[model samples]
Target chain A: MNETQAETQTEIALDVPWNVVVHNDPVNLMSYVTMVFRRVFGFSKEKAEQHMMEVHQKGRSVVWSGGRERAELYVQQLHGYLLLATMERAI
Target chain B: MNIERDAEGGFIFSDVEASLAAMFRAIPSAADPEGSKAALDRLFPDPAAGKEAGLSAEWADYVRPELREGFENASTTVEADLEPLNAGEDGWTIPRDHIDAWLNTLNQARLVLASRYEVDEADMNRTAPYPPESERTLAVSQIHVYGLLQECLLQNLE
Candidate 1:
């Protein structure tokens, strides 16, 4: 309610980091997966490919880790684009 | 076109074009073509009985005439040989290599369409003004198609 309290709350909220993970699935093509990463995360082609490779080889990869809210948003957007995406707290 | 959410909470597109981009990616290439073709055939068989059932001319125009005719011919052939291959149980079982070739063809089509329509990369990224229902349908189809593809590939592997 108070200004100081509200300010502190905002700062605290910004401190938490969230992890965004893209799970491996059977259907989506590897190239298409990379393209989705580039389109959603604005990653360079190389970086996107790298992440996509990680998913292909390892079954899943943490494409991103950041604030919980933003991570959720990324997961939602990726899901919207038909990627199997999820989020969790980064330990 | 408008989109609607079905009882299952999945998105349904008023026009197939909104979902075609993602659908086009499901076809397999030579290396992984069988699964891709199978998926494509499952979704778009020749004659497209689903298309004929109750589709509008506007929706029909979403399909390229040649592609439409190809589907029809393919479906008919598959139907004619259904007993031998059990093809009628499903649709045509597209070989993976053929699917891959189809993907290349689709990419070329996209390139040509982009140029013809003057669709810039930036413009493609810009949010198109779609009805909420349509947007939801696009979202659902995009996710469902990818999920289904992943499932089919896994099934083949098993």
Candidate 2:
């Protein structure tokens, strides 16, 4: 492809959003999950608990949605805390 | 185990088994690259879902090293804190700053036990009592002990 086409494709790729999700697991405690959510995303107690509840009740929660790089970073951070987390391209 | 917060806000656990503290010290070395793959795999699964093999590989390549570093750090923190234990005192103190480290390490230990026992999510939560002397019963008890520890840390953290 030509340079202009390559540059345009790069920009489009960069604009595609990704969603960072945490899946509920039987092993992790609810409180531990809440604390991890607060620590990683800097969510307030209420917000973090809400997401924790969502994961508990709904099986998964979209904790963040934004640029792919940032989403990947968030997923990695969650995994570091041993949270079951993943990222997917936004539809 | 009995847990309470000190005046400085750090957590102290009374009745912590000397054996358990030794186990924490052993976690970092227990992560043998070959033997511990199954446990590590569960702890840090492929971040991408479905048939996205290429994406999963790319993500793993980028993230695995950092995850390894995190595991080492957690194990080190727990070891340092437990260094004072000499088999006499069945207890340990977790400074407020190292709470996260303790949480991560304890959770990892639980995951490793679950992996070793071949327990699924349902089995881990199975309230049905195993025969009292069975290894499964012992495994279940250990897992719950880790859960209680995590809960105590969370309560004090708040």
Candidate 3:
């Protein structure tokens, strides 16, 4: 309502962490997903392969967790590689 | 068909038959998601996964176009590389730099075909060597071929 209250709400929203998750796709190759992870997030080969395996064995993997804006950017990069990725506000 | 690395670390596919050449030429069109909503949705997925309507709308207006442009550019690169094949050549060379574009374009085509045909892991494993009797079967074959191409690029990339 008031400027101070609005500013407080905005700050609260900004403070909340968000997660970038990549979901499993029947079409995307494991090696391809691993490569995308390496390129987009600069993940190491082992780290990227670990997450890729998680995504393959499980349904999804939380590849990154941080500020909402960064999470959104990561999701954008993942989507650019045609991976099934999303950003969600962390509880 | 056989694939080998060129002197500059690029990939050269030799002995590409007419059918394989045809498949290479089809990459650009197969990557086009205009006619299939499923393919389009898979390519430009909602980053928020439907949780935030505002974010979804913002993504559609601001981000989707950029993504589409990137896909088109990759497809263009692949199409340009296939010019020799289009001109009745037996094979084409993927310069080291163009590897990413080729991989991306091939992936796009595979995803589009998979989405359109509802292909799953089972479909991918179906390698009976039977002649494709239906459109769906042909699409499956195409997906496999495109996937093999992607794998070839990845192996060379590594």
The candidate that wins on lDDT is: 3
Query: In model 2, which regions exceed 4 Å deviation?
Result: A1-3, B15-36, B50-55, B84-86
Q: Where does model 1 exceed 4 Å of error? A: A1-14, B1-158
Over 4 Å off in model 3, which ranges? A1-3, B127-131
Listing candidates in order, what is each one's chain A TM-score?
Answer: 0.82, 0.91, 0.92
lDDT of 1 by residue, B65-107 (tens): 4444553443343233223223112222334323322333333
Q: Determine the C-alpha RMSD for candidate 3 after optimal superposition of all C-alphas.
A: 1.5
Choose the strongest candidate by DockQ: 3
Chain B TM-score in each of the candidates: 0.28, 0.80, 0.94
Clashes of 1: 14
What 10-residue stretch in candidate 3 chain B is worst by lDDT?
Answer: B123-132
Compute the lDDT of residue B158 as modeled in candidate 2: 62
Query: What would the per-residue lDDT of candidate 1 be over residues A4-89, giving only the tens digit for each residue?
Result: 99999998767867677886654456666776788789999899989998987798899888876576557555644445565655
Query: What DockQ does each candidate score versus the true complex, computed on alpha carbons?
Result: 0.01, 0.74, 0.84
In model 3, the Cα lDDT at residue A4 comes to: 100
- Order the candidates by lDDT, highest first: 3, 2, 1
